[model samples]
Target: MANQASIETRDVRLWYGEFQALKGIDLDVSRGRITGLIGPSGCGKTTLLRCFNRINERYDYVRTEGSLIIDGHNIYAPDVDLIELRKRVGMVFQRPNPLPISIRDNVLYGYRLHTPKAERSRGAEDEALESALKSVQLWDILKDRLGDRATRLQLEQQQKLCIARLLPLKPSIILMDEPCSALDPDATAKVEELIRQIAGEFTILIVTHNMAQARRVSDECVFMLIGEIVEHGRTEDLFIAPKDQRTADYIEGRFG
Candidate 1:
């Protein structure tokens, strides 16, 4: 399949109060691929990831300039619907945050919210729940435990559940902010495997501090510094032979 852009940004800049978090970011994230954003702390990796769904605008003083286009629609347009935009672009946080409700409920929460009540029959809900859990390799383990509270699962399971929930919504893009930061080595490996398995099905944009993980999971990598992109290219090219000195230094551990 030909690689197409799932997301496009032109001169995208964001500010919180008086502090500029992202400065003139222009990027094209390809469809059905994993693009990793890597940089030192406070480099605005998380801020740029949040811009896809306009989550930063939640704060009253937050301001954004320039256009952020997703799936041919400019999300910053006045007539855009925030609720629908979020459904198309899902997010996984640094930590697993599941609802206090049953596992079944958590999986169906977004589906129920976005889907019309008249079309949500018991059979359809069951199908969606099972499909989502199976996609994340949780169906065999959690199918019997669907009645249990979601928060009662293991940390790794919780994070996988978070990803599964998004699948039911059929999101075109999924943004992950350090999704494996909370897991142990073994759990991280399992989660990374899951990410790889789902790569060609959805466009994934991940912000990660783990260079090894970025190299392992991403097809393309983007390195940022102080709210600006320094380099972006194929993962191997960026790591083995970077085009920019800043990228080389960071990859070589000379400096963050």
Candidate 2:
């Protein structure tokens, strides 16, 4: 069954300085399901993804003119609280960025930003941190080495930890921008498994160049072209029986 709408963009448009990046895209990402955003380079997939969490709001002359709604709240509104929206719509970047602190401190960093630790009891923060790590299958590996520097871990492990850090806040949706682009096959498989395991708990929207990775992880897929979505449907039909020639061409490796 098609899941509930987790995020919806209506005629969304974005521009940087004088150049337009996203050209009035209208897309819906369903809750509790993985949605893939695939297109050629510079097709605005990442720009469109950044809009969900208001990440583009910081860019000068990056004006947007359409409604971008998350959980019934219009994020583009001037009155919208960006901090709250960002906390709810956490993002994982392509590269894993662990802070220059200990492993335990890295997980606690975002928590400190969102909540007060001193006001809470002794075990509350650590409990939440551990729970998040366990959810991402990193607790076992890092438990004994919590005092170690985050930069010391393997690249893949650090990436998973970056994801683990977000879980402490209990985000309703996750925005992943080519999160597995830098990982090897083994690491990518592990992250994919983690995504599958956590899907029903939180809505996930990913932008990727890897068609197979999208096919493997996403329940629904959107194929974009030149800043416009050409097709979107259940992954099986979209891949097996694409409606558009462009989609077929991209899927069949005839062209990107």
lDDT of each: 0.94, 0.88
The TM-score obtained by model 2 is 0.96
Candidate 1 lDDT by residue in tens digits, 1-256: 3465899999999899999989999999989999999999999999999999889888999999999899888999999999999999999999999989999999999999999988889999999999999999999999888999999999999999999999999999999999999999999999999999989889999999999999999999999999999999999999999999999888888887
Clashes of each: 0, 0
Candidate No. with top TM-score: 1
lDDT (Cα, 0-100) at 131 in candidate 2: 93
Q: Residue 217 of model 1: what lDDT? A: 96
Q: What's the distance in Å from true for residue 233, model 1?
A: 0.5
TM-score of each predicted structure versus truth = 0.98, 0.96
Residues 82-173, candidate 2: write the lDDT tens digits. Answer: 88888899999999889999988888777878886566654887898789889988888889989999998998899889899898788999
What is the overall TM-score of model 1 with all chains considered together? 0.98
